[model samples]
Target: MKIKDYAILISVIMIIVMMVIPLPPLLLDILIMINLSIALTIILVAMNTREALEFSIFPTLLLLTTLFRLGLNVSTTRSILTNQTGGEVIETFGSFVVGGSAIIGILVFLILVIIQFLVITKGSERVAEVAARFTLDSMPGKQMSIDADLGAGMISDMEAKKRREKVSQEADFYGAMDGASKFVKGDAIAGIIITIINIIGGLLIGILVHGMPFGEAAQLFTLLSIGDGLVSQIPALLISTAAGIVVTRAVSEGNLGTDITKQLFAYPKLLYIVAGTLSLIAVFTPINPMLVLPVAGLVAYGGFTMQRNLNKEEKLEKEASAKSPELDSIKSPESVIDLLHVDAIEFEFGYGLIPIADKNQGGDLLDRVIMIRRQCAIELGIVVPVIRIRDNIQLQPNEYVIKIKGNRVASGEIMLNHYLAMSPGIDDDSIEGIPTIEPAFGMPALWVNEDMKEEAEMSGYAIIDPPSVVSTHLTEVIKRHAHELIGRQEVRALIENIRETSPAVVEELIPNQLAIGDVQKVLMKLLKEKVSIRNLLAILETLADFSSQTKDPDLLTEYVRQALSRQITLQYAQPNQALQVITAGASLEKKFAESVHRTEQGTYLSIDPETSQLIFQSISEQASQMQRTGIQPILLASPGTRMYMRQFIERFSPELPVLSYNELEPEIEIQSVGIVNISSGAVNMS
Candidate 1:
């Protein structure tokens, strides 16, 4: 373990020891929870970092406080009941009034929800990031090892501030504070509300069911006891949790996707509703109904306030609609059509320069091309490319070795032999008695010596050995096929070169960045053909070093190249290119546009029948595409574009379909895309 981890472990152990032994009962409850929390924090830090732990502290502290109070009540009441007259009665009374078991049960539930929140939100994000990063490593020049040592925790506000101070000289601290305030205040307030509601509900449940108004629940409900008491509360706990989820879904209405329980309780309405119901139950179940009556009133007050605020918002929206009708120019249907437009564009292949090291570089040319084509089709709107593989021979290291094990004959007789034994059938001019070769009846013939014929037949050996020239030719062909099938260094070098030059080139060469050898094909295409701005930027970086070495250019030219490289690098650096483009385009249009015009008169405030009809058609088309491919369409267009779009649809011979941006519905049933407010004027999109 690292020294830091060791220190934390030691400190937590010391704290746990103190908590178990000498601390007062009340303090012990607090210290025990704290100790447990510290242990948990350590595990989290080891697995993640400080940022993740910071989010857990609020819920932990609130739970500990509840447990501490529960313990105090139990100890004091048990001491009083010890002196009572009836032993069993006093014992029962003590259990109900003095024990703090209820709070402990509540604490467990809180911890579970906290864990769910972190895992759901952070866990999902971490998985996706790791996948993308892994996929990226296989691409050309961008390949680099990611250090796993980085903590999983988000950077702390204080740490973020410090980093920002170092990074931004002209940026204002207030801006940083504004952003931090949103999270801290929002999370803290939400935590407090949730804790209060949970503790109150549990307290009420304890009073009503266990007859413990100020003390612990009866013996049956003491912490960790395995009986009906624990089992029955499980359903109640789940119901509360479920209610919280439903309430949060209705109220929050956004991506609180991390912890369902935490988000559910984040809204004051859920907590208030749960507390009110539990408090009312306590009154009827024999506890002093008056004690819960006030609590119920408080919960009711909060609920009423929330309802009033929502009503006010609704009224304000109505008034605003009346005042400026033109504001609601975009409609739901037209927006969907705009989204489809984004999905239909396709990109063509653009290759970069290939690094060649040998004449056999052409062997893998098709495989390389196919890889790039598929990637471009996916990443740059190009279609899948066709790929083929071929084989070629390569020279081996042992080409010069030679050995001879036969006799040569001249004039139909053996001229020389390494070893020989005289035979009655073997003539002096025909040692081994073999005719070398002769054309007889238009066919070649081979003869063996009469004396060696028996030995050759016994061994079943070939009468004539094969020609070296034919054997050599077959060997060369086999070697060429094997080398070609495996791919050669030339192909590898070319791919590597392309990868180093342009990341886009690398992206284009592989399907999901899996083709490591297609980088060369990408480079070749980029250098040979015309391409888009994105591809051009990719090639600029790929060719920088080559250009610098081969051509003596002015400083201005080099500076331009450097600028272009930075731009492309920045583009690739964005987390999601498509989303980035949409947002960036929206911002630019918002700045440039003044007003949106409409077809009908009266300031054309909302989606009228004409716009609505057009938008309906657009949304219908988009809905169809969404069914085919599960991708949600994101519509981004200027107010002017929305208007022109509507007009274009009306006049076009093919009956062009377009969705309007102004008429988006609040719920998913009506609209899936939000209306990006770009200008002040009316542009009817529906």
Candidate 2:
């Protein structure tokens, strides 16, 4: 242990020894002085602390100090009764401090005991108990707040951990103080008892055994006992007051002295009023003017000085405000640089829709955004950046807009008091409501009031609340643009996350075989086609294998998709059911193969505009025919033509799923509901 650790151990041992061993008067005097000094130090330290936790060890220190005081009392009581004197300190306190009167000495001691026991000790104990209880009660709330901040990305894991630890430490500190305060109360009671015992025992020993008269014995022992009590109780009082200060200390930016001066003298006008009252009392009342007038003058002078200083400060503030340095900074070039940065995703709503995102007004949109980020991470294997939600005054009251990379991608309107009811494939004529389109799916929906909600539900219309409507629209917008959100930084984060468990695959695939941009491009391609990259290990492993052969992201993505065929198959194919799809005939595949022109930058399809028009017309007819049958149209093409086919088809039908033959599992039976051929210009069902 260090020297300070050993010193504390030795001090505790000496306190125990002071109780049992007989000490010389000189040693007792030194110990008493040491006790007084320590008590003074403790209260000073307590007053200087800005928060209770700053003095966390105070509870344990209080126990030790109380024990040391009691030990000093025991030694002094023994010395007073046996030797007819305690020490020079006690004798001086008895004779000079109390004016050599035993009655006055005893009365003073009792008053000190009353003050410590009835006032400081009792208040400190109660405050400690209440603080401990409240601290414990608030622990769960503090923990939950930390967790919420963590989920919202407002704080990192290390910051959250630190906050949680601080909360726990606060609870423990208060609880220890609660128990330690009982020590102060018990010490006060013990001081009173020990003083009484010393007086009774000293009187008996002096009169009966030392051949002294009753008056002399009473005078001698009573004075010594009172002195002993005074000597011990003074220090005890200081320590108890210190305990009160520590337990009642609240979190503040300043110490007790600073806060007291700053807050107590906060208003110089109040000082002037006090001074005026004092002057009136001195002038009109029977009070002595000579005694009160001078004090009143001092108070009035203080008020005037303070008021003058406050005016000077106010003038300086006004001058600073007129200068408006903040406006100057805003007009600076550096401030304009900040405006160049843009958020990855921004959700802006009109002022009337503030409650949709404000938790105080019963809005859960912020919570829903947290869930959206998590959902994206789990389903798309990419961490979605924090969605910035703010109110825009320029928009209509009910309109909200969703932005990706500073560009508005989607917008919708919400009625606060109405529920959106979408028709179940057929419009209900009986349902009377304002017609609207569901922002999430663009399906025909109605804004029905609370009165019509039940009828709409009974009519088999899907009922969604306004918040849900906004959240659903926001969620779809994020999913649709998930690819655009995953940049190189986000890809690096994913790589680091996977590196913890699959370091080999990550190290081999990233930078060594392909750059983060390359990996990001592959992931983006997968997300664009609505593929789940949750099984990132498989994706990374596929990239590692084929990246050496080709640096092309498109080719690498195809390889990854083929490796994730089982996932793709499970996503679209139903159990024990044949996967129905629109197939591209041999003629179209051959045409795409011939039209593919290769260059250094990669292959491109250079089909003539006539053939392109025919392809689009034929594909649209087949897709429309399949849609009429209530089936999602998926165009199945050979591996070589699938990427080009998807790239070509996305211009008109971005939502359509274009799957390659190798992207499907071999066990899945393919049933062609329609075929796209160049000559037919329409689907031929077979």
Candidate 3:
């Protein structure tokens, strides 16, 4: 240990020794002075701390100080009883401080005890108890808030960890203070008992053993006892006061002295009012004008000085505002680096739509956006990055745009005072409203006012308010671009999450069989096809099994899909319902297999443009027929051709799902509603 550590240990040992050992008067006086100095230093430190935790060691310090004072009291009592005098400090306090009157000295000692015991010690104990209870009760909420900030990317993992540690330290500090305040209370009682014993014991010993007169014994012993009490109780009062200050202190930017002066003198007008009131009292009452008038004049002058200073500060601030330091900052070379950082997701709206996001205006768009992120996390199984929301002056007043990595992915307009009403496959001419298209799905809709909202609902139209419209549009945009959002960082986060529960699987798969980037590719491919990676454990295990066979993400993803056949089947097919799909004919599958070109890098489809056009036309016809029949078009192909077919279909219809036969469950029946053939121009329905 360092010297300070050894010094603390030695000081504690000395306190323990003082209780049992006798000491000379000069040494006792020196200890008494040191006790008073320590008390002063503690109280000063308490006042200078910005928060209670800054003085976290105070509870232990309080206990030690209380023990030291009690030990001193014991030593002084032994000296006064044996030698008929305590020490120079005690005698000086009894004679000079209390005017050599035993009654006066006793009264001073009692008053100090009352202040320390009934006032400071009692209040400090109660405050500590309440603070500890409240701190413990608020711990969960503070932890959740920290987690929220961490999840929102407002703080890093290290910052969140530090905040959590601080919260725990605050709880422990208050709890210790609650118990330590009792030591101060007990010390007060002990001081009173020790002083009474000293006076009574000294009186008996002086008369019987030393042969002193009754009046003389009473006089000398009472003076010595009261003096010793005063010396000890005064330090006890200071230490108790420090305990109260530490417990009651709030977290602030400044210490107690600065906060007090800044807050107390915040309003100079209050000082002027008080000065006028004092002047009126001086004029009307029997109070001496000579005493009150000058005091009032001083107060009024202070107010004037404060007001002038405030006005000067306001002038300086206005001058600073006029200079436009922000423009100068933008011109600096360092500002260019700041512009390079693009948010992963940004939602920018025009000024008129601000009320939809501002809480004071009763807008819940921001809340809805948070829910959108959570919903995407549950459905897509990816950590959505923090969505930065701001206002853009260039857009139309009612318009908002959603951007992914600085590129606008989707845009929509909202009418604040209206609701969107989409027809239920039948338009009612009676429900008249402004025509618009639903931003989320491009369904035909109308912006109906409140009057027509009820009417449109009664007419079987789906009603959606402006907030829901924006939320839905934003959600769909996120889901559509989720693949682009999940990079190596997100993949690493996912791997870490999995490592928490299934460490063996994660350790075996990551960097052992495939790298994070390789895993990211597989997840992105799954997400692009609207597959949920929420079953991450299953996905990881599948990769761990097949990754050694092939390092290719595409082949590994195909193997993963086959492994998740039950999830894929349940995703698209209803229970006991035959899945209706457009089946690729033998000739089309052959064409896809033949078109697959293999390089050392990977395999890719290299079909001719003419054949691609014919294939696109054939698939479009089948999809249109399925749409007419109210069925979503899902193409079923062989496992070898499924990935190539998806790649080919993504160019014209990126939203389409092309599944392999192995991706479906064995229990489910497959119904081919249409057939795609290269030889034939159209799809043949089965």
Ranking by lDDT: 3, 2, 1
Answer with 1 or 3, whichever has the higher lDDT.
3
Residues 277-359, candidate 1, lDDT per residue (tens digit)?
Answer: 86868866887878777777877787677667767888998998786645444465765676663211111111111111113
Each prediction's total of clashing residue pairs, residues at least 3 apart in sequence or on different chains, is: 36, 0, 0
Q: Which lDDT tens digits does candidate 3 get at residues 255-325?
A: 99999988898898899999999999999999999999999999999999998998999999998897878
TM-scores of the models, in the order given = 0.22, 0.77, 0.77
Off by over 4 Å in 2: 77-85, 140-160, 204-221, 325-331, 349-386, 390-398, 414-418, 432-436, 448-452, 486-686
Worst 10 residues of 2 by lDDT: 677-686
Better of 1 and 2 by TM-score: 2
Off by over 4 Å in 1: 1-7, 12-30, 33-308, 322-375, 378-545, 552-686
Give all candidate RMSDs, comma-separated.
32.8, 5.7, 5.4
